[model samples]
Target: MNPASPIRIQGIHYTLPEKQVGLEQLSAEGRLLSTPETMRDFGFGDCRVSSVPATVLASATVKALLERHGVEPGEVGLLINASVLPTSSLVPRGEALAEFPSGESAHLGLFRFSSTRIQDELGLINARTVGLSELGCVSLSHAVWLAHAVMLMEDLKYAVCVNADVFPDGIKREVVYNVCSDSACAVLLSRNPEGMHLKRYHTLTRGYYWDPDGHQNELLAAYFPTGKRVLEKTFKESGLAREDIKLLVPHNVSLRSWEILSRFTGIPLEKIYTENIRPKGHSVAADNWINLKDVIDRGLVSKGDHVMMFSFGLGAHWGCSIVQV
Candidate 1:
């Protein structure tokens, strides 16, 4: 994609659940597999727990993005749901595991499509809906790339990429030493060359590590090297050096891991935006987008500055994108 006419981010909006649970509370309730001390050492202070369903959060995010940017719902030409968890599996966090099997039949769950529901509820009549999964934390990055490609091919003017995920009831919030949170983010992409410009992006998936539980150790071993490779490729393709990147918008995972990655990629640790790590925790694919929005909102980067976003997904996926603001 040409940088001159790149896919621009018009607006970004993210919604977190009202309830905030501290690490100690989750540990006490047995909802977190790791100890509270371990999680706190890993840089997680608290995470948001959704009392409502994921679909409601997703819809509200998209609606807020449109309203904040003064864009009508009818003007959105593409809508991509990039949630890590399937819509069928995303029920209210407060619901019990046993009640889920009896409350909603398999048929009903199978037909619960978040993309279409958001479109219908938000009145995105002209938007083409698509749902993406399996990429795990990289799902939203893939959605952004897909939206950009589809818009260029179809001559669409506006595209909305929304991602939302919640841990099913009775499931542990700790994953590979990182705390998880329930949240949704919506990013509006336009062809009018405004906001952040999508300069270059790269993604890699290693199917050999598909079984997260079975290959947890191996996945952890490969995370840093694979993530470094993706970041290097993104910088190389964007024709910029690590020093040129004004900010590194990262997925809200372990701050220690990011510190190691910064050393591996030769990017200074101070360049990374880590303010959200403790407060927001990891909201799956929504982390990078949420952080990016906050970075822009706080004036962390000036116009024409290069920003790099990177994330490692549980399904053994590595994704990196360099954008110009």
Candidate 2:
């Protein structure tokens, strides 16, 4: 395999609102789509839900990230919004958006353009805005991939990768099996290596599950087989074997799925971090990175240790990123 990319994750920050809901609470409230027992079997737990929209959550974290690193908004070369469930934005963030009202004009359907909104709201005047949709939970890491490519191609310095999610009212927090949570995360990427070393990113998708909202059965059937193939390829491309990886940073999905996946990928279950499965549930795009920060903080992934982050989006996107700490 070739040498890995030199891009670095300068800083990663995520935010979850104060509101929390437990599985039992949801069960009692009759808001869970799946029965409490089934959800618990998959990996039931409580999660933080935000009252604000997803865009607001994303913008708040991005602003905080800029302040934490002492980076000016003008220094941001690209702002990539990678969110699956973007809550509706009632107000326009830009001057041009005023021309089109909510129900008038052909601008946006219902979901807002969070990239430009964040840019305009935060005065990221010089930063070009972009978004990655339909990738579901995979879009977050894919944003890293896109950022790496853009910076390398455009000779840019700093790229802001943002992800956020919000489930509407009356919607079930559990999908398929993994529980859902509202959260936002921001990752500052740079060509300069001063922080988390981003080694390689690999992704695979099955279009058969493109419209999986009504086709949950087929999506479930395709998860393991397709996910295993991509994960094997991800490990291969990173030049790391099963035993070479010290840890597998997983998205906050189901423990049962990871149990079966360990047998397929040959990575032991002990290496897979699952402590957050109950605490945060599946934090959509924030899961892998959140788990990553936690494990690194606890000395689970040490210096020079090889680690892999794996995630499967609802739209049948399976991918992983292999990093050397």
lDDT, candidates in the order shown: 0.85, 0.81
The 10 consecutive residues of candidate 1 with the worst lDDT sum are 92-101
Tens-digit lDDT string for candidate 2 (1-325): 1265666788888898888898888877767778778888887678787777777888999999989998999999999988876342323444331222445544654445778889999999989988777888888899988888888779788999988887766777777777888888899987666577777788887777878787878777777888888888887777778888889999988888899988886778998998988888888888988888789889888878888999988777887998777
RMSD, candidate 2, Å: 3.5
**Model 2 TM-score relative to the real fold:** 0.91
Largest lDDT belongs to which candidate? 1
Which regions of candidate 1 deviate over 4 angstroms? 4-6, 87-104
Q: Please tell me which predicted candidate would have the highest TM-score against the true structure.
A: 1
Per-model TM against the reference: 0.94, 0.91
Candidate 2 has an lDDT of 0.81
Per-candidate RMSD vs. true structure?
2.2, 3.5
Off by over 4 Å in 2: 1-4, 86-112
Clashing pairs in 2: 304-325
